[model samples]
Target: MLKNKNIILGVCGSIAAYKSAFLVRLLVKAGANIKVILTPDGANFITPLTLATLSKNPVYTQYFDEETGVWSNHVELGLWADLILIAPISANTLAKLATGICDNLLTAVYLSAKCPVYVAPAMDLDMWKHETTQTNIHQIQSFGNLIIEPGDGELASGLYGAGRMAEPEEIISFLDHAIKHSMPLYGKKVMVTAGPTYEAIDPVRFIGNHSSGKMGFALADELARLGASVTLIAGPTAQKENQILTRIDILSAQEMLNACTSIFSEMDITIMCAAVADYRPKVIANQKIKKQADSLVLELEKTVDILATLGKSKKANQILVGFALETHDEENYAKGKLAQKNLDMVVLNSLNDKGAGFKSDTNKITIFNKALECTVFEMKSKTAVAKDICTAILKILK
Candidate 1:
């Protein structure tokens, strides 16, 4: 859930500030862009250089650097973050946050931030349990900030109590659960088919299209981002998903069909985006044919229409989508497929459109809904197109 997110990590004065380094590493490894903000007191426990190296971004220490004469814009830093996490938040910083004190850059950024703020408090047991501190915690929570409650363990005071900072792994898990729980497609099961199916004529030769699976892979990633549990059924392609998802690789249309049908009933949404072969060689040659003939002919048979079969068996609550790559009469063909195959929607693209069609990183598309209403989109990168498509799906669900 943290993938591609811009996060500002706040480290404050506390012995637990040492754990912030581990947290930064975990966030970076999870594909998040990290910016660390260290209070002057925090520097005493952990060096700013340590966090800067782990986060791969310059650490913000003060509002201005005396030597470099560079000013850090706290407002811009606050606005840039998707989330602000204050780990090892000392009692002093927590009180400052609750009371609107901006003595330091970290507190100033917190006050300027509009994104979600999560704080993990770490202090002595007596300080944590103090009535004033409890009041500040409540005040912070009332201002819509989340608190990752400290764990119970031995603290810097050498006394065991409930004042230890939560481990880095625990904090990551907490963030993921909090983010995903609020996503639009949270708990939705999605299936996406991608790439070009190959039909074998001989052991060494086969027929395939130019599909690179970029579109389908993009869709899978976007759906996953919306918190859906996605299963990607892909034909032979070198493409890879940006996020972790269940992937089943196949080499032929038949294999793709079998894979989809087996799980179609359980899916809330299914997108048939693969360029499946329409015909396959009727007879498989046991050995390579010698170059003895000037020409050759092979009988071909129609492959099963996987999308149509799924549409026929589709549940009332399921949303089935298909794709149409047309040379002429694009709208008519797409609408025909939308109705003929009982699809909820059909995405149309034409080879005539430059930067579109097979193997391109970009595409121009028109989406037709079950009501025959069409929405045309300008040429865009596959990733942006995926977001648009996913937004359309969300509208339908709404």
Candidate 2:
């Protein structure tokens, strides 16, 4: 359930800090990408090399390197994480957190995190039973932080009470259950098509377009990140594939059609972002054509309308989205496609707008639903555009 998730493991100073090694091992084994942060005292308890080797990432201990002087931006780290768990949170760290202290990298990240925060407190029985500790825990919990209650066991001081950090296995199980239950798209199956299809004219040549497949790939990644089981149908492109999705690679429009048609009925949502060729060579030449003639011509035939065909087979609960790239009369053309292809919404981008077309890193888009409600968006990175599109899809799904 945790596959491809970005998680932060914060280790604090405590005897229970040894347990964090097992926690990191289990999380990584579950296919989660982990970055570790160790408090100054936490480092004295555990070696950074051990955590680094197990997580396959560099461990963060201080705010900056003395020689290199490179600062660790806690805000970026906070925003990058999907979830942050501070294991073996010491009494000192716990008190600091409750009082809004930013004395350490881990506490700084906790305060700045945009994602959910979890803390596992560990201390001796006397400290754990103290009124001050209880108050600190309650204060942090009131701020929307999840507290993993410590287990009752023998403490490091040879005293037994409820102050040991939860077992690593128990922690993992709780997170697994929590993550799935909170995901909006946890059980939905989504399909997205991207890139440009090529039609072969001969063994040596083919017809294609300039689509780089960045937009479609971005959508697929975003959907998967939101907990959807995504199946990506990609035409020939140089785009890098993101992990955590089922991707089918094809070169021709016909191959893409076959792939989508076979699985369309089972999909809850479908996004057609591919720039499929409208026409293809009428016949494939047996051999490469020589440069004998000054002028040459090949008959063109209309290719199968993959999006329109899928639109025809869509069920009532299925949400269908289409894309339109135009240079003139964009809205009309996009609305026409929305109606003609039975789409729930159409994302329209115009070539007339700079940085918004084939092979660009950025785009400007407007969305039109069947009701003809138009929502225009400013030029943004493809990633942000994908987020806007996902938000629109969520509204339609609701």
lDDT of each: 0.94, 0.92
Clashes of each: 0, 0
Q: Distance (Å) between predicted and true CA of 65, model 1?
A: 0.9
In candidate 2, list every pair of residues with a backbone clash.
Answer: none
Which candidate comes out best when scored by TM-score? 1
lDDT of 2 at 257: 95
TM-score of each: 0.93, 0.79
What local lDDT does model 1 show for residue 135?
100
Cα RMSD of all models vs. native, in order, equals: 2.0, 4.4
Instruction: Determine the C-alpha RMSD for candidate 2 after optimal superposition of all C-alphas.
Output: 4.4
| Poorly placed runs, candidate 1 (over 4 Å) | 158-160
lDDT of 1: 0.94
TM-score (C-alpha) between model 1 and the true structure: 0.93
